[model samples]
Target chain A: MNIQALKTYLNCDNGFLLSLVQKFVEELNDTTNKITLAWQNQNLTSIKLNAHKLLSSVKVMQLKELTLSLEKIEAGAASKHISSELEEDIKQLDIQVKKVINDLQLTIEELEANSPCI
Target chain B: MVFKCAIIDDDPFFTELINHYISQVDSIECCGIYHNPFDALNKVNFQEIDFLFLDIEMPEMNGLEFLKSLTTLPPTVFVSGKTTYGVDAFENNAIDYLYKPVSFARFSKCVNKIKAHFEHTRTNSQVKQQNIFIKHNGIHIRLAVDDIFVIRAHDNDVTLNTNVRSYKTHLRLKDIYDMLPLNDFMQVHRSFIVQLAKIDKVDGEIIEINGRTIPVSRTYLGELYERLKIK
Candidate 1:
């Protein structure tokens, strides 16, 4: 899992993503694990709906890479034709997103640490 | 928002035509098409559909009566070869009525009418925002409500100029007016709707927008002043 890429994906400015993590973080060691669980459990219906809502909001915010990746996963799942190899690739992509989120949070903490709000 | 269109007509050729027309326009997606109205209604019950391309004189359930049966109805555009139903169709407050073998040109006009209605409703809903979904060759493009810098009404169609690209939608000035947000847009001339915020300055007859001159018609100059609230 490319944790760095995952950090970048989740580090975006959408509150929904933050809320998404907060909603499901307890279920996995990483974002990929959680998303994979959703897929393996045959929750594509929920995933497809969430992916679409997120796509529109994310497009408005200009998160092109993240939006595209989410679209690919959703479209494949909805079509019910994605290979196991593609699923593995999506899992890797999930780790990349997790890294993005981690980096963004760390950067925010560092900026706040260097400055005194008091 | 993408419009999921359900088409009900016995003719497969016309159904195919409707599908072809829908495929050309990105705004309306063809969700389900049925020769039997009852079958179509069953599908509608299960799926979330936004628009219906209905034929009035069907075998089982008539289009008009079916509309009455809907718990919640989206806008509909009627397609029929006979002209007798045109007035009744319009009276039903359907978005637009079309005669069978719907031409691309007429189809475009119908789409414009629907877009205009949605635009107005959306503006009223948001109070100060207007957004348009543009479908050019089956691709839906969402433009920001305020991104339209100016709109130029040409020979038959209107060209929307924004900060990014020039979008050509088949529409007339009168039709476009209803869709534009009242707060941000004002018809200053016969062929122009200037974004009030985009107007750099207003002279006696002309206003400069994006370094281009837009005329203020004698008929609409007063309207512009009212819109501008110029003291």
Candidate 2:
């Protein structure tokens, strides 16, 4: 996760990028929770929809690895039953999203420290 | 001139990102950001908008479907994550297509294309507006220069005949003739100015126009012959 590279792509100030990252993390958390609940209930439709929604933000963040994982989960959700491998993929997706949230928080802190006002 | 634009996308993040990119360009203005295509369809006036940044794969009503539903569409640029929608976007006359994770560089290029398109359209419209307006029965009637067949003067009123209808206006024959294209229309009589293209057949001193035989006076006969290239 090259946070600086993503910021350059967005071409926004540190404050704006920080706000975007915070929003993205919040949305990601909510979507992950939805996927988990849908999986527990064996509602593949809900899982597919939630995973599809998550893909948009992940792709924007340029997290290629995470994007592929989410795509697999989204595709697998269309199936009647979740295979053991698909279950492992969902578990990995949760970990990967949380790791991104942590990395983004660190980036935000670094950005805040570099600001004159801070 | 600043071009007012609207963004119709299901994702709030994508809309926000596009809005941010639009702010970087000085000539483009963000008028509205609609998260729902259905809401945009109901609210947006296609004629009023200068540009539209649309996204495909939206829930409920997709971008392509929404575009199909519009009676008139502005220049549209499709911003989608999926590359498969590119073919359909161009087929529907979209100005450009920017794949998701759209960079500011890519978005700026699309804006340039839109500017060129607007300039081209404005130039064409200016040429089309070379027309004359006459007041008939308290209403101003506009007639294209090429559409007017003949102009006849009777005392104080001038009747202007066009391909569609005729209008009787209180204007001088000379005044209306001055407004018409000099090369296309010629005064063949004191009260009649016939569009050269509208003259079907000329027999002796009379010219047939829409079943009406208008006589060419002797004073202007030589000039008419010169205009018609008659030996």
Candidate 3:
């Protein structure tokens, strides 16, 4: 996604869009854990499919850094390259997700502190 | 006492509103607020709850189907956005119906009905030994052991004096006397059957309850003295 559009979506106006991002971040953390396990188990199809899905969604979420890294992982899985560099890039993406996730978590906590509901 | 209540609907906003309402209500405590009926169904199947606050339309499983699947039905008060399901909810044995954007007043009304039913059930369960079915006009109502103080036969109908109201029903005094449990209810005369528990004071030709007097007949005098342990 372009930087301007990313800024607009993250503006989140009334906090609704922000909550959806929080939910997405929550799902991404879970899917990343699953993707790594599938890769280690040499389930190439499962690994490729999971990385592809994450690649598309993280771009929508404006986590361009993670999105680009996941696309490489998807390509490496499809070609059965299983190279150490591709593995290191995917590992770095996991750390980046954790950091972005912490940022979203803080945003959610601040919003909830202001207005609590279901 | 808190009753476990489920809030089922597909709107997160409404679910949040319901959660807010439940937190404020004294009698009802929230079990969970679900945005889908399937999630609510999973909870109901696993939990022992006293009541359900179900919404009609859901994605996979609707409220009506969920209510049908319950093996043990707690009293359900349906919450919907419309009134067309009144007959449907009632036919499924719902205790009450609530429309969407539920106002506190309407919610209060539904809870009041559930409160009354629960209170009546608690008292009835304790006094199962003796019951008197009183016919008021065309309606037949069950009066429990603690309800009846005295039964007075007036001309062609039997007058049942209860703590709440007096009902006159067209049945033979003999038939009414026979209907009561033999041990607790004694036919003291042709016109009266006095509850052995409720007779606070007894005197010549008069049987009383809480300062009110009911007449006694000569034919049943022996039975009254026998019950009162009079010499």
Best by lDDT, which number? 2
Model 1 lDDT tens row, A29-107 = 3434545676777666545544443443333224567667767776776775646854765676577567656754664
Q: Output the lDDT of residue B163, model 2.
A: 84
- What lDDT score is found at residue A55 in candidate 1? 42
Best by TM-score: 2
Candidate 1's C-alpha runs over 4 A off are A1-118, B45-47, B129-231
Q: Kindly list the per-residue Cα lDDT of model 3 for residues B2-48, writing each as its tens digit.
A: 45677776555446545655655566667777776666756654343
DockQ: which is higher, 1 or 3? 3
lDDT of each: 0.64, 0.81, 0.68
Each prediction's DockQ against the real complex: 0.01, 0.30, 0.03
lDDT of 1 by residue, B45-98 (tens): 433455678887664477787777767666788876556888777776578887
For every model in order, the TM-score on chain A comes to 0.53, 0.86, 0.77
**How many clashes show up per model?**
17, 0, 0
lDDT of 3 by residue, A9-107 (tens): 333332444455555676688778977788678677767766764553465555667777887787788897667876787688779878888877776
